[model samples]
Target chain A: MTTKMKIKTGNSGGYDVLVLAKHPMETGNRKDQKTGEMIPAHFIQTMVFSVNGTPVAQAHLNQGISANPLVGINISNAKPGDTVSVSWTDNKGESDSAETTIS
Target chain B: MKRRTFIKGSMASAALAVAAGAGLLKPTRVLAADWPEAALSADQVDAAMQAAFGSGDVTDSGDVQIKAPLQAENGAVVPIQVTTSVKADKIAIISEKNPIPMVTVLDAGDGAGGLYSIRIKMGETSPVHCVVSSGGKLLRATQEIKVTVGGCGG
Candidate 1:
């Protein structure tokens, strides 16, 4: 899946990173309108954030997270030219990563 | 040893050395604690909280703020934001009505500010709780959200 992210430097010399990911985030609790079949659970299970290739923070997510999830976090000791990257792996073993330069 | 095998073995070890030098394999483990698997999988709210923080002794605090809509048009995706001035070490989001109440957990390292925003699913109308842990104390804030359309795949 493709993911979009942005990094903005705050006045306090810290960086704020926002990530938007594209996923079904299916809870598997829903049923089909016609067949009434259960939709299998599908969602991002793990997300890792890194700065300049160094891991900084990570999150464990479940079906409770909404589709096209949005996550924002602040990082201290960050600089304007540093690269912030976010990668996620879903329960289905599918994964993707994206990066943006702090500005 | 064969030349092909020798070349491949050296290349693999070289890559490993580079990864270790960059401090990729161990820093995240030290910075972020292990995933609270038991808490996330707990079916009940109280059980989940107990597993997450050792005790569900959460009390309401004005320092914690949870911003969410009073009524959500779609339960599939409700936007929520949490901000805390309490110098929290961890922040957890819980859905009262979902089969598994615990949605996500965020651990804040030293000097890292506590600010998180994400969208979560709600099975029905329920009180969404945001729990912040700081200095061995648990502080909480909750907001009731009305779900017009159920997102539990019903």
Candidate 2:
């Protein structure tokens, strides 16, 4: 799905990594605009952040996350040119990942 | 004829299963066991705390910081940022008034520094709670965000 991500240094001199993926994040309570039918629940169930191949943070999420979810985490002691990656799996077992250098 | 067709179909299915077990396909599939389903589905804050952390004895703490807007114009997307000074292993975000109180849980590794930022959905104005699990103790901080428009559903 080619998830979009960004990594920038915060005021603490630590890397602040942000990832935004295009997803419906349906709560299953909302109705469709045209069909007027309830949309089935579909949302990212888990996300994992890794640095240089080692997982640094993991998030267990639910439908409460906003649509087109944007999540961020701070990685202390991260240096420039380090690889940062974020991957996610949805309720339907679909998964995708995005990786980039820390420059 | 029917018996022969069934045997051929079974053999084809068995061959596909063997290939899948051998890791011939991409291995990014995450098992449902990776998430805490009970906690995520809990309706009450205390129930969620117990399911996630084994206790509901969270106390207010000053070491945790929760950054959010005083009034959210669109409850569909409310930004929240959390950072804790204490040594933390896990952090959970909860909205007191939402149908499902628990929003998400973050497990911080050694280098994570107990920091997280995300956008969450709010059904109405509520106190957004940040609970941190550190050294077997639960510490919490909260901020009330007033929502002008509800975000749950129409």
Candidate 3:
């Protein structure tokens, strides 16, 4: 349930933070290939982004998001060595977080 | 005195349980309580707009931009970027033709003002809508994307 996140310094004098999370994002309408049983909905419901322990942005997502969801935002005034973190929780009550230092 | 104290203790614990049950105890994480279920599950675009943005009229604005290919090769993963000249407190993506019209909503706090990028699924060719909530006004922009393959599972 871990997410792959990256932070890049943008040309406009801000940091571009991106998070790519791995999940099936099933819409509960998909059927299994072998069993023909419908797969229940399993997608990340919320994602929270923080900088240096302060919450910055939050995203409300659903099954409409692509599998291995990727989201990005530009954070201003972030200095080198600052920690930017992202955490996500899914419909199945599973959650994981990742952090990266601004370089 | 003992009976009164016992009664007070039970009531306090009951309140706490109710709050926790509503998923309001976690301050750090955006819990299910904050998720807009009605809007996301709304089948039609107009219904979804009502659920998400209430009855307020959303005017089309030239300041908002939706950057995506006019033709998407893969409906499973279509990259979309949104930028706005207005101060964006929140940004919402809606696909007109999907089973569920509302895709996702981003609460752009002070740090992330007007730039957001994400990947979404599109069932077919449809007009992707971007609605930005700035101040008390709802500004919107739409772009039609032609998808070769359907994204939603069959």
For each candidate, the alpha-carbon lDDT, in order, equals 0.82, 0.88, 0.86
For B1-154, candidate 1 gives per-residue lDDT tens digits of: 5999999999999999999997544332111235566887789999988988899998999999999999999998899888888787778999899899999987676545467788998889999999999999999999999999987765
Query: Cα lDDT for residue B125, model 2?
Result: 92
Per-residue accuracy of model 2 over A1-103 as CA lDDT, tens digit each? 5599998887665888889988888887899889998777788988999999899889888989999889988888679889999999898788899998987
**Residue-level lDDT for B28 in candidate 3:** 28
Residue B113 local lDDT, model 3: 55
Mark the regions of model 3 whose C-alpha exceeds 4 Å error after superposition: B1-31
If you assessed candidate 3 against the hidden native complex, which CAPRI class would it receive?
A: acceptable
- Residue A88 CA displacement from its true place in model 1, Å: 1.2
Instruction: Please write out the lDDT profile of model 1 over residues A1-103, one tens digit for every residue.
Output: 7899987764445777889999988776778788987666778877888888887777778878988899887787777788888888876667899989876
Off by over 4 Å in 2: B1-31
True-structure RMSD for candidate 1: 10.9
Best by TM-score: 2
Q: Provide TM-scores for the models.
A: 0.80, 0.86, 0.85
Model 3: per-residue lDDT, tens digit, B15-117? 9999998865644223465777777778888887788777548999998999999999999999999988787888899988889889998887886856789
Which candidate number maximizes DockQ?
2
